[model samples]
Target chain A: MARLGRVLLLLTTCLGLLGTAGCGDDYDGLVIGVVLPMTGPQATYGEESWNGLQLAEADLRQAGTNIKFKLVLKDEKSTPQEAQTQAKTLMELEGAHVLLGSVASSNTKTIAGAAKENGTPCITPASTNDNLTTGNPWLSRICYKDSVQGGVLATFALSNGWKRAAVCVDNESDYSRGFADNFKGAFEAAGGTTHFEYFKAGNADYSNVIQGVADANPDVIFISGYYEDGGPMIKQAKARWEGKPVIGGDGLDSAEFLTLIGDAQNPIYFSTHFAPDAPDEPAVKAFAERYRERFGKEPGAMAALGYDVLFVLMDAAKRCANPKSAAELNTAIGATKNVKGITGLISLDNPDRTPNKPLVIVKVEGGAKKFHSTIKP
Target chain B: MLADVLLDGLGLGAIYAFIALGYTMVYGIIKLINFAHGEFFMVGAFVGYFALRDLGVDEVDLPQPLPILLAFLVAITLAATAAALLAVLTERLAYRPVRRAGRIAALLTAVGVSFFLQNLAVQVWGAGARAYPEPGIWLYVDDLPAKADADYKIRERVEAVVLKGDAIDTARKAALRAEGIERVYRTPDLTKEGKQGFVLLALLLWTPVLWWLVKRTRMGRAMRAVSEDADAARLMGININLIVAATFFLGAFVAGVGGVAYCATYGSVKPLTGWIPGLKAFIAAVIGGIGSIPGAIVGGLLLGVAEFAIPALLEQLGWADAKAFQDALAYVFLIIVLLVKPTGLLGKPQREKV
Candidate 1:
């Protein structure tokens, strides 16, 4: 009984420490901690986002604001745990006023709490996890939420009268889980039945998953994973049995995916954050052109998001009387409206803090994506 | 669903068996797990990929069986031989000196070698899954209509072919019914049926040869002697190091072939692709009596069949998402086998020297 009492006291102390921790901030005129995975499997995402951010910083400085800023770039290594540690070091050590980036949705989710804990405003340039902004006032994102994409896809399924569906989710990924959960919810609410088969990231085989889904014989299949796994899964599935029309989200957007799928004669669809061919307006085209000139390559959706989010952050910071303050920055960001982004118009009027935007649907066939239709929210 | 499960399980299991063979052979000889065996498998795959890419076999727009045969022979042999050489090199540099240096040392060295090979691969080929250059011959359609405008045209053409096949089948069925003949014929999916049959036949043909090589040959005699008592065998004029090197080379050769076959089956290769299958193969080796070659093959088939069949059966039983756990759940078979027959199904229990 004495031992138990001591253990209870220890547990209470630990909980107390946890509850009281992560609520301090030191700010300067402009010190944004830019955390991203510059080297790893997801190094491409970080590099692209960093490139856009660099261009954004250059353009913003040229635009000439009274507010001065210094961006401290840290490599997050593409893991949430790493992002959390990096966020802490940046906030507690570097004295950052705001935090930007960690392109993938899962990485974003990792740093969100760190930002809240440190009382520092965190804005992800490209992460689209649906539940990211649920209760975290200090966390706001510049991309469309995963649930919005899921909801849009759900609407498409309902309108097309595709009642039964199967999903192949990357079980290891938080990004996939959020998208799958939201999709399942929206799908069921509209009276459609959906089932999921899962595989981990880096797992190349999907014969079992395919067998399960094919046996179920769903009307359509949703692959909620990156192109690496999804691409091969589709190819192998087509080899064995006649799979239904497959659908996925932005994770399917990769040149590698097209090559892996390689002449698979299956009707496929995916909803992407942006389509280069279908620019929102003239400014989007102009921004894209400028990016091309600077980067010497076609800008990906991540690059565009990184560039736009920087400008978005500048706009929000300009609105706040004290841009250095985390609370003021958070409020101004949440209150943002009518800001035209390269992807679409950004607004945060909803209590949920999800950006109101349209999702671009593309038909992926024979290693190319053709603009199908934009699903409007 | 059950049949599909069985078929895929067997298919996947075969690859596991090939990978398991290397682990079982190395462990049997030295009582050390060659963790780097999987990396050899991975390297073998890369070898096959690069070979196909460089030979222009996948690109030369060749007519039929010629290109297919060339890819199968050239890629598989090249990959197997290269992997064998790597295995010998690893055994010499990594394992040879550590032969008497305790089991933990050898195991750690194996791990270090594994990491070195994987990172070397990553550096050479930037961390990405390369499309296994498909040699467009036989039934394998490797040409992806990659041109921006070709999407619709190729899709339409492909669809037309399918429709034409369906129409022909329907007409044949109608003719059979009118003639009062009752028989069903399937347009054989040769890619599935022929390929699996070929793999199975190749496995059967080689199993006895492997058994014979171990049981009857002079090198086999030397191997068995060294394994039993290296000092005693060395005193009796057997070259222990040479036999060990030979064993490593042979095991790695088979593993490389397995890797190449995997790429052919799946149409892509990544550095990490072989890791899970490699681990499963180790489990398979353990299940089959880790030191036994015949046991590895049997264990592979058993594991493969179970790996595919369980989740499929579970799904049919309305446990819809059960297939996701199939890979993890495969361990149940290994655990059960270990518990029931600890010496493995084909193993002769090792007696303590005391």
Candidate 2:
């Protein structure tokens, strides 16, 4: 009877210790929601961004900070409706305090509205549309807006003494339209004459419109379309208008364009958030090397923006005394300024959450991109 | 504006006509719409790309005319051979046992085959799009002169006092430089005009070949007989299996040609490259009266032209946002044509007697 009593006491003691261990450590883990296009046409962007976020999470853990992060990943599926649905689910169902998300501008806009309705703080990693966070106080971005990119590309053209410019924009897409408009605005402001032509998205033939532009004798042509149409457009335009410089926004950043042009003599220039040849900070170089090591290829603007957004969010989280509450997190994020990122110094200047970051210009030479200049706003 | 729109439409229409022939031919014989037909086109393009690249044909440094000709010939033969083998295998494995089964079963199999081919392609070739090397020489521009010279005269008063030599060297130099630049500018390595001429030549050559196969030879008679009445023709010693296989081979060969031509025009290939064009071509075949070979050609061309023209026309009529509506134009035309003439433009209505 005495031995049985001792055995029961030891079992109770062990059970009590196990219960305490299951309850976790001293700090309550932080849960941040990530909504992105995990599947679909933009899945590549989502996958790369997720990789950057994972790297940041690892870095934070290695820093020996008491704060532990729990990431809740949701798929946006690259559609506005799906983005809004995912945002709502993340905030309401998942009970996430802060959200990071949405590669495409349209998707970002939709999710931003949802975040605003729920009073949840959301940071978009790669969306460059000018209007997403302009008036919305709850949304933030780590990349430059279309206005900045467009202005920079236009200024570059004018600085190169391009007097007459022709703009070919993707009419069906808001990103193309906004970028083209800002470019035109900046170009005309710099004393350059602009003629605008619009092509519908997925329209394969640009021969007629391009030929018309050639006849008009434009000194430069600005194309605001994704790499799909951009590649073919450059090839067709080069065929018709020899030696004309074709300029574009971040949409033309892909290596696929070089493949499409295939030794064409025309020089193609584009404005993007980051480039491999740009002045590399230690953090940027580390990220680039790590990215190449992991992916067996160079990272693009989306990857850099993704890596920066995570650091920005982490910095905001560190500032808040009560990081668990959504309201407190939003207030903390709104106060972010001059965070040194892989892309550049990111400052959330407007509490309204507009992206006012810097832009980089890159030119395609010899089947690869060479960094030209950086434009600061 | 209409003229420009029509011209643009016609150019695109020509491309669709080529792809549509592949779909119509197979469907006309087998009554099975091969969903994986589009991927054959993709395969052809990649094969052409590798063949040219292996031959060391760079974008800036092209091979001699004979080598290029040999490369294209070899590439086309390989594409046609691969497509034929694939078609036969697809039929034997996926469709043969289920030949007499319901239409739904065949369709389901086709969809399954399409997914299988797509996934296989993705596994073999990475998901990223591959760029095809552009041909280096401009066949049309070789006849043009490399440079041009301009002459300027200087007056000489020989009797009065002095004779002056002409100083037209500077003017001639300037003219030559300008002409040189113009010549360089005018020559594009990948000439769409040249490709179009090649497509026209192929069509002209193949028409007679197809006509002889279908109307003159024993194989053609057997194919026609089998297509008209399979059971009766089988009893009449037509050799149904052989005829069916031959038809598939011929259809796949044509499809391979179409695929190569499409890739040559686009200069880029992707795993999903075939889906849109294939769907459009299938719709073209349906619009042209599903079982008629010539109807498929006419329908495909019309559909391509219509797709291009509608949006351009709409944009000219002050609907500047008409481009967004371009994708829907094909279905709209299909619906209108199907409603107006069930037998199609060139299709004959079959009569049945009980």
Candidate 3:
């Protein structure tokens, strides 16, 4: 185990070197430094986000673009405070012209301030808080807002003729709380009765809530938490609910979720930014195929968005004459519109840089999540 | 709803009581808190998991009651043995040298050992919580597995093929959209009860067995004698060191049982699985009177009932929004105990001559 960890550390160091150093003498002078939670509670998201960038780099090289930018990666340790500290190091110490990522909405909020203060363009791949980009023009996100996510879920549930619903939300996280609150409002507004239970991340017991929800006996159970908490909760629920559908947001989208649930036959649905089963264009299909070949697993929504963030940044850079200037890069990022991505067409024309995109319902089939349907926003 | 909540609390409290046994027993024999007791619980859990899921029987091949019973026995025995050995090692290596180096030194070492073990588990398993095999009852129907190994294999194969599919997924998506959401109405509230009853029964069974060991066994007598006065007991040819080691072993054995029961109830295990639960159990031990076995059990049940039932009751009172505070409730109780009865519920007030 120690040896594996050492190897992983070595691999990370190598990847970091490859990202920051010019591959050859002809490499461009642009520097895009990324800060992500690579080693803490949110490590999986960071690893996936990094893979997305690698895949994006390969795609850019294949396109034969003359523009070359070195990448510098920093670990945020999955906390807003760490993100705040790391973002400064990336901008000042690493001489980063542009910044992207550091997942969770709270961390993105911190990065947002750093970008504004540093005058460097920062694009987040998957921070969904509605307030993330409210006043920070230097920041943008590839994913949809948490507010819209919950409403979309309510629409999906009501559309399916399921009137009664019971829910669980991870109140410790703003992302989970945002979606759960929004879903409750939307569901009730549409005249569906609902019951709500609450939990937090890092907690293992949900028996009390499970029993309470089981008694409520709704048509479906909505879990507004990440895969870590959602996975076991579903298993416990399945033992009682007897095949009831479990719905969640993009937070529930992880390969580990399947590992925890372990062959549960019950229907599990989650709303996500991207679906490998259905793509908006042929490029998406190609990207998915290449990602599978490279990583030995299908790319998740975060990876897809991470890939899109790169293109979005590149598109912004292509339009800029003075690409090396951080201020110029910031301006170019703000003007981004209709850049093609494997997830969808990237357009940051909205004032807060919110993307006008589609959301899909992914159903857990066998052990993998497959597209159930798409909702146009 | 109240009854269900109570059952849940009782079940959790039962786990706490078992873990608390280790804390209380060790403290009783030697005046140490054994901060690494929680890690011992975690270690025991992992050991049981390996024995049952990785060694004793395959999840698919197990034929109902027989395999489950066998697996449970194996899990119990293996976990207890590992925990006892771990306790002995920790005492010899980390505690023995610091035994006369002041209480604070031993306490610091205990904390360090706890952290070391947690990080070690994280390195071995990664940070993700691995799924524990489902309880035997969940799979059994008339003493036989409800699903065959072939069914499990096929499902795995189907998942693999679908995940790898670029062409097949497109075809499946078209079909999925048509039958998308199956319409169902509200289920009967009373129709489902959580599996806490099983935990209650399992825990209740351990009470008498532990009572027999403590009251009627030779080791238990030595343990009591040492607790009274180690120096005096040693002077009488009681082999004080052996008695202390035996106490640690017995305590850890109870902790091992606790670690196994906990994950079996929760459905998953992680490197830090026992951290919070073990902490709460220690609090339970304190409230029951830190060095008292009966105190630990009583304290554990009380803490469990409060943890589970408080949230349920609060939710009913329109304060369901207070879920985050439930974790803090145990600490609150701890503070209250310190203020009201420092000696604990079953503990006698200590008299210091100084």
Which pairs, if any, clash in model 2?
none
Indicate the worst ten consecutive residues by lDDT in candidate 1 chain A: A19-28
DockQ, all candidates in order:
0.17, 0.12, 0.25
Model 2 chain B weakest lDDT span, ten residues long: B154-163
Instruction: Please provide, for model 1 over A61-164, each residue's C-alpha lDDT reduced to its tens digit, 9 standing for 90 to 100.
Output: 88898888877888776678898888888888778889997778777877888898878888888788777888888888878888888999888877777899
lDDT of 2 by residue, A76-130 (tens): 8668999999888777766777889988899989999999898889999988888
Instruction: Compose the digit string of candidate 2's lDDT tens values, residues B199-279.
Output: 656765765687688789998788777777778898998777777777777777777777666666656666666777878
Give each candidate's fraction of reference contacts reproduced. 0.32, 0.23, 0.38
Interface RMSD of 1: 12.3
Q: What is the interface RMSD of each candidate, in Å?
A: 12.3, 18.2, 6.1
Q: What is the lDDT of residue A60 in candidate 2?
A: 70
Residue B186 error for model 1, in Å?
A: 24
- In candidate 1, position B223 carries an lDDT of 84
Q: Write the number of the candidate with greater TM-score, choosing between 1 and 2.
A: 1
> Local error of candidate 1 at B179, Å?
48
lDDT of candidate 2 at residue A186, scale 0 to 100? 85
Worst 10 residues of 3 chain A by lDDT: A19-28
lDDT of 3 by residue, A1-377 (tens): 43554475478679868865532234358888899887656777888889999888888888877677877888887789989888888777767788898789899889889889878888899999899898888888777888788889999999988899998877678988888888999999999988887775666778766776787889888998888888888776655767888899999888788768764557889999888878445777887889899999878888898888888988888999988887787778878888877667777887988887778899888777778888976
TM-score of each: 0.82, 0.78, 0.82
Q: After superposition, how far is residue A178 of candidate 2 from its true place, in Å?
A: 2.7
